[model samples]
Target: MNTEEKGLGSWTEREREELLELGHALFACPELGFQEVKSARILEDFFEKNGISFEKGLSVTGIKASIGKKGGYHIALVADMDALEVRDGENAYPFHSCGHSIQTAVMACVLKRLKERGIAEKTGGQVSFIAAPAEEFIDFETRAKLKEEGKIRYFSGKQDMISKGVFDDVDCVISMHINGDSGGPLFDINSTLAGFMVKKVIFRGKASHSGAAPHLGRNALHGASLAMDGIAYLKDQLPPEAGLKLHPVLTSCGGTVNVIPEQAVLETYIRANTLEYLLEAGEKFDRCVTHCGEALGIETEIINTTGYMPFAQSQEITEVVHRQMLELCREDQIVKNVVSGASGDIGDLGYLIPAVQFGFSGAEGRIHSAVFSVGDEENAYFRTARVAEKTVEAILSDPSLQVKNPDFQKKKEFYLREWLGENRE
Candidate 1:
């Protein structure tokens, strides 16, 4: 493919080699969310080596670097740096099963190339490279502790970043994920994802010896099981268009099989295509679980945490990205209107700014699975950076590129109040 016509742009051989090397290094030493000490340091080292000034330790393990002199509009390229915790058989460790390593490597390369080519200066716009943390929403106990210590406010990385005003000056945002489906395009554009609310239910009861004093014990395990059943019965009540999803995992059932359980916990997420339906479903779930606990005469404590919102890419910005994507791949290699059942923190950012997220197909297994692996390094690492570079160029090239969602602040207010239960200042 002709470099200019394909929008691939030209990168030095050294640049390509460095990107793959970084990718391999990141993949080799995967770290979990909010605890990516080594991963953040590695990216910080890369920035320092490239003469790129950056701010480290935002949201504990997040980093931000700026490219191009301050001038016109500001665009941001966000890359989540945390890995997922996946367990298989007898082995379990933090792994890049979600392709975040590839995303981080590509984002770093994009900033490097933009600086090398003077693209940002020529286009007269500034670009921010944000390495965000805790996108996977795992390691809840640790995150809760961080919140208690006042080190972090939100569970998701982007939400915490927003709360800290990290994105106050950013006019537009772009990011990407991995699509493992072989039938899908090499690049999926303007795809939408569901929004969700996090739920943690703890059932408290008195413990007693199973065989000696069973009547004296109020079994929390029984209460949790009954709650799960109540939630399951709501499947038919949920509207089909709502795309409601309820998945619960029993984290703790009992201390031992012979003891009457004193406490049990259930962690779950209530997801829906629309925020209205999501909130409604979440309320019903809370009610259902509370009633289940009351029926069993056990005390239930419900902890509701804010989650991501539905993702809607800006039409104008999406058009710019779609045209550039067409230039980079064949017509058949571009997929539109892609909607997935999964959720992401990017959706939270999308509600506040003009944002667009795309995907590159270089993953071989289902997301969050042990078999997930990077299938094509060229496509995943190098080509993705190329597309990102072109997208930034497109945004910067137009000086009159005024982009904003009219409903952004309205949704932001609601998100703060409803999901976060925070009064607006």
Candidate 2:
């Protein structure tokens, strides 16, 4: 057996089998954000089996669990519990096609070996594995309703957790995404992700019968069309470094074709790498909407969301992890720095503490597609777990690994102050 399968001879067959079963079980049960009944229960059961202790439901189905007596280094590991929302012939919601099932299972497996190695006892630090909800950011209407009912202040689980002070005491945090199985080039360094602005563009005018009174009505739909055209023009002006994207989807308009639609709602995701640049692009967007509304005599309300801070990995922590990766390197691989066009909550966490997203791909196929399957389940569950274990071991065993990354701290402090708009209270 490989070192990963054996867990350095620490993990047992029974434990590995249990972990594998948990993976498939999660795949079978798909839950949406803030409504993860089955997912939460399965995770809780895993903790119970492993003798890990945790507090339940900080903010709707989010479980905060910890192992080891060491609170000194107190690092947190995160795994999103919610599944993707693409219809898989279900009577209700979508499926776990994104493979969060693998992500959670792999983390659980790592936790097992960490226990066997006495990592918690030796490192004098604890790893809090959190099954955070709402990472997928699904169902805007339901999220809006929850916001109104005061059940959640924000749509995202991580943001809500941050608001509740879940991360106030944590030092560093990490999470793994199952990017299908592939060979090298799985992980990236200082991976910059897309920052998004969720906005609702409502164009309002007047409605009248289209047959005889076509000129009597001022059409909101026409104004929306103009706004989309303006947004499309941004591609040329956008900075290449911005990681920019403008996707405007028309959500609601007048129902009938005979009447001019008085009110139209367009959902737009305005994204970029740097906030300054994104803010600039946002100004351009606002101007375009403003022009469209004014020209069409339509009133538009632009509501921009509390967009997530960018995911900028700590170079210091990344450097340490890379060095450790080199020591653990196989002949087929080398640690690398890669750029990502995707935006995630991981960047939001970096605003509070240093963060890094190390990726692993065993095999490749269409991810998030209807026909998607794990590229190499055998290697992913076991080998990836070992990679996590080895990294955690280095962090605990090497005092140098515990050495602070000054650059990471500096950037982290900067963003935290910027995001919080003041000192953290």
Candidate 3:
């Protein structure tokens, strides 16, 4: 169908090609959180060529640009720039299994197309484009090192950017995530999502010869195993409605067969739908790990870190995006009130602004897995860009559009002090 018949905004054939080409380029060369040097350079080139003035390296390769009047209400469009550490569909090194490459390309295309079409100049508000890094909660060691160096204060990209005063002037925010399979619907509006906290557990014990003086050794591996068992038993107390999810992995165990293991490490994420339930479950979980270490006579240290907040979308924003989505897809192809147990740093943005993250179906396999890939490039690139672009246009045109601030959106320092033990380094 032609642009007039389709009811969605128009984009040139060249624009479509650029978006798809960029998407594929990003997919071919995936990088982990806070390490997206080449990925950031690609976007920087795009912005420079298109005359979008941007500041580079906000949180290690993050980019931001603004268009429209300075004093007007600001509308922000954000895209995560980092990819996953999972093996690709070919079972190679790192890949874009989480579809962040597509997401980033779509956001860039949306902003570029809007600028080319003169929508920002006509609108009364300022529009900002933020290419954020480290959305995925992986690479904890790298994030910790950055934190210790006083380079960053948080693990996730959005939180780090917020701390750096990136979104201070922004009012409304929009983001798109790639969902699994283009089967049931082309688009979905997120109704809600769970938030989580990170925990790193270390068990220390004395090491001794396994055969000669086994009685003198204190086995830390045994202590970690007992803690895992206790955590399994504690699952019985988890209420189903709280949407609690606790998955712990033993990252390090014994070193060799001849010596009793002196150190063991465990890492986990505690997720829940509400802060009250999350804290309740978190405290209980801490007790389980600590008591297990005490029972085994091993020293234990549990470090708590803040995670994304529970996602709550503005009803008005959802209504606006839903209307724009209907123009792109048929009524049957639109899904509403979708809830997921998964967590995202976008939820942290939602707490501060009237933010909404919608999903588009273009991939086939399970998310965050090796087999996940872009099954339909057309839907993933051009079509998805159309929806996002139109939504931004609609919101920018409305002068009365305003977001209601909620009480639960706490300051960034609260999280740093309460969870991360931060007080200006």
Whichever of 2 and 3 has more lDDT, that candidate is 3
Evaluation by TM-score, superior candidate among 2 and 3: 3
RMSD of each: 3.6, 4.0, 3.4
Give lDDT per model, in order.
0.85, 0.73, 0.82
User: Please, what are the lDDT tens digits per residue for candidate 2 over residues 228-340?
Assistant: 89889876787788778888999999659898889898988888887776777778898999898899789999876666766777665677556544544553454454556
- Return the number of clashes found in candidate 3: 0
RMSD of 3: 3.4
lDDT for each residue of candidate 3 in 124-181, tens digit (9 for 90 to 100): 6677889899998888898999989977888888888887789877888888888768
lDDT of 1 by residue, 75-164 (tens): 889999999888999889999999898888889889888888888788778888999999997788999899999999888898988878
Q: Which 10 consecutive positions of candidate 1 have the poorest summed lDDT? A: 1-10
**Who wins the lDDT comparison?**
1
What's the C-alpha lDDT at position 250 in model 1?
94
